[model samples]
Target: MPDRAPQPVDRQLPTDEARDLISLVRDIAQHEIAQKAAEEEDAGRFPREVFTLMSRSGLLGLPYDSEYGGGDQPYEVYLQVLEELAAARLTVGLGLSVHTLAAYGLAAYGTKEQQTEHLPAMLGGGLLGAYALSEPASGSDAASLRTKAVRDGDDWVITGTKAWITHGGIADFYTVMARTGAEGPRGITAFLVPGDAEGLSAAAPEKKMGLKGSPTAQIHLDGVRVSDDRRLGEEGQGFAIALSALDSGRLGIAACAVGLAQAALDEAVAYATDRQQFGRPIADFQGLRFMLADMATQIEAGRALYLAAARLRDAGRPFARQAAMAKLFCTDTAMKVTTDAVQVLGGYGYTADFPAERYMREAKVLQIVEGTNQIQRMVIARHVAGPETR
Candidate 1:
């Protein structure tokens, strides 16, 4: 049976403008993204043009200030837009999330002159971005990263390797964190390096189980130099900036998880209603019906949790705990729900002919990115029960 169009989510948008924005996003997702998702992913093709279109449409800077060519929308609205795009394609959604994260250091900490000169192009001028924090030896222990930047006359020469960088080779710029002083987090500083910098290069993209359309690679900064003006915040401040960005970036991951789960649920439901057993639709079976119910409940709950966190951020409240909780819950939900979705389709779900298997593979990454679920638990525990004795 032919697949049916997935139903639109009923969202409680704060304003008419937000509602229209979602509607526009849905239209773009359905027409431009969803149709190509499966095919491109299968071929491991990144949709660079789609990102350019998003940049042109102002989707690239939804939560930033309008003064610098951003949409100036609140986090609540921005995250929902992420959810919608993710429902269509995770590469696009998570790519945008990584882009926002890459832009965070400068947007939140750069000098006024830096913002005026670079923010406009970064936000809306068709430039893509990557964040550089993780390294070959330091993934979760980001503070232990070995990348180093040395101050020259008027430039900082950075030398190191960054691993698992999204859009690694293709990005127009990178927000890099490197050691500049004593060891640990206090030694780190952030710099914005242009992709075309003479010494910047990327290794081949990783061969991943899913989200193949999104490039992940090792970015090499062999004496890559940038003017001192590209430094974000003061020296010894990059770790704090990275943490602040992750607090929000976690919410983005949460939203993407929910959207991926929603897509899986939608696929399962459509298949169940059409496939027959004992001359009746498989969806009518009590066991299968219960599974669908649980999947739907989890997706809805995940959506609500992420949105709540987003609202806290929008209101300027302390939401790091909530964000951690949301990321932990939503990603777990995605993994479970997508797995259940595959079970619903029985034999067919295991095959590449359907997207259930793809969804399952994609769902696994959410639990690992933007701070692993294990890290999320640690973050939450630190907030709730206080830091562990060491």
Candidate 2:
């Protein structure tokens, strides 16, 4: 028999409204996103229309204040919605996460006037955003970025190349970190640069191992100019703003990782129950069953870890350490679970005819994005046992 469709996750939502919201998200995932995920991803096609639909449906700004076109959902509810989207398609889920990351500086630190003027359009008006912090010379050491933003009267002229920007070529706006003062982290400033500014451009997308449907490219700002009003937060405070945004962004990545691992586990289970050997389904074998069991356990643990971190965030408490721990563990779980899923299906898992191979490939990137697992470890270590002395 053909593999059975995966069952819906039995989520422990806080309210009837939250449950209803999950139901709506699941319906969209099943009907609108999941149906063409494989085909579109294989073809490297970005699903702009799906994002448009999500914006219209109020899914784009779930964790922000409703006064500014946001859904006003807490991080816990929002992360669950992200999990559903990611289980259907990682491209969509991670894309939404990147959009939220890009909007964070403005939403969290912008002046009231800035929020009143721009938040509505960005939150729900069908605009896509990109976060630009990584440069050609700096990835994990984002504090060392050399992108220059020179003040000229009331405008800032930004010039440099940002590497590995999600939605680089296609974003409507970008939250860019550029050096505006001396050297090092304290010199940085964040700007809200329009994607189509005079000298802003993106190079061809990178040929990545996974998430091909989501464009990751080098964004070049050659004297790109933005008015002083477009600056996010105070000048020389960009690094702090970026770090604060990343704490929440790591949770988003963790939720997406759990979702990806869940999908892999579901695929593995379906294959095990249907594929036969020795006159019985492979699921009857103790070894394969054990693998499945382990995969499931890891996924559940990862889900719990990310949700606990999300709850901490929703409560307005310090969660950077928990967020780092969640990112590290969940992404590691995704890589392990997806690889074991590939092993479960044997030869068939290695082919494009099934999704197991794609899941494995996609799982690898989760370990590296937002911040590498190595970076996460450092973050956790700092929180637990004081900063390392140089």
Candidate 3:
């Protein structure tokens, strides 16, 4: 089956420029991305060329500083672009989000010299990046990570394995966190490591149910050395940096989840209206109508939540709680909506002939990545209830 083009999302943009940007993104998604998305994803083929084109077109670095070869769009605008792309293909949308996350440390916390040196190429010069934070032993309890980065005269030697790293093998740069002192979050430090650094290796890609076009694998940093200049923020600040990136990254994930849900809703509606049963279209059934209505409502709610969080970020205000809530709600909505889309199609949806099954499988991952929905609840509760006292 041919890949379905992303239906336009009715966006409430802040400016004419934002509207034009969304229009451009929709054009690209319809012509370039959606057309090849299904086939490429089915083949588990990574579209490096698409990313290169995005880099050249300045779409890869929206929401970063303009001086650093970035588009300088606000987070709200940038996120809607992500939503459109995700509706076209989850791999492309989520890959771009990870790249943006990988650049967060250098953009937000790097020294002037480091920003001038690396941010430009990283943001738009055809270079891809990955963030390395979750270790094999520390998925949810990230503060308990075991990766170590020991100071060696004028350099740091990094050794440990990072798990579930997107773009693990193909990334050109990695923003890595490692233990530098005592146990726990305070001891963590961040480093910028080149993917080709000596002793850095990526294990085989995971055979995942969805987003297979994107490589998820274990990254081994065995005695990988980087000069002191490559360190991101101050020593013992890696966990904080990681958290900051994730707050923003959660919004990206929320946007992707909303887009995926929207796509499923659109597919369901199209199929329901076109496919007839009992001498009438399924869309005429009140039960199916309620399901579609709920799906659309959830998608709209998730989109609004992510946009609200993005606006808060744009205003330099506190938004962590909102970001966490958006991630939790939007991802869960995606899982629900995609599941309903499969049911709307019945047996036909269970097969690979339709994209509903793929959307369902893809939606499952959004709940797990960035942070598990359970972890997102903990984050939200921490903000809502304050840190629990002994």
The number of the candidate with the highest lDDT is 3
How does model 2 fare in lDDT?
0.93
Weakest lDDT window of 10 consecutive positions for candidate 3: 1-10
Q: For model 1, what is the alpha-carbon lDDT of residue 100?
A: 92
- True lDDT of residue 78, candidate 2: 95
TM-scores for every predicted model: 0.99, 0.98, 0.99
lDDT of 1: 0.93
* Alpha carbon lDDT of each predicted model: 0.93, 0.93, 0.94
User: Model 3 segments beyond 4 Å from truth?
Assistant: none
Write candidate 2's Cα lDDT for 122-144 as tens digits. Answer: 99999999999998899999999
Off by over 4 Å in 2: 1-6
Residue pairs that clash (backbone atoms under 3 angstroms), model 2? none
**TM-score (C-alpha, index-matched) for candidate 2:** 0.98
Please provide, for model 1 over 1-390, each residue's C-alpha lDDT reduced to its tens digit, 9 standing for 90 to 100: 222244599999999999999998998898898888888999999999999999999999999989998999999999999999998999999999999999889899999999999999989999999999999999999999999999999999999999999999999999999999999999999999999999999999999989999999999999998999999999999999999999999999999999899999999998999998899999999999999999999998988899899989999999999999999999999999999999999999999888899999999999998899999999999999999998
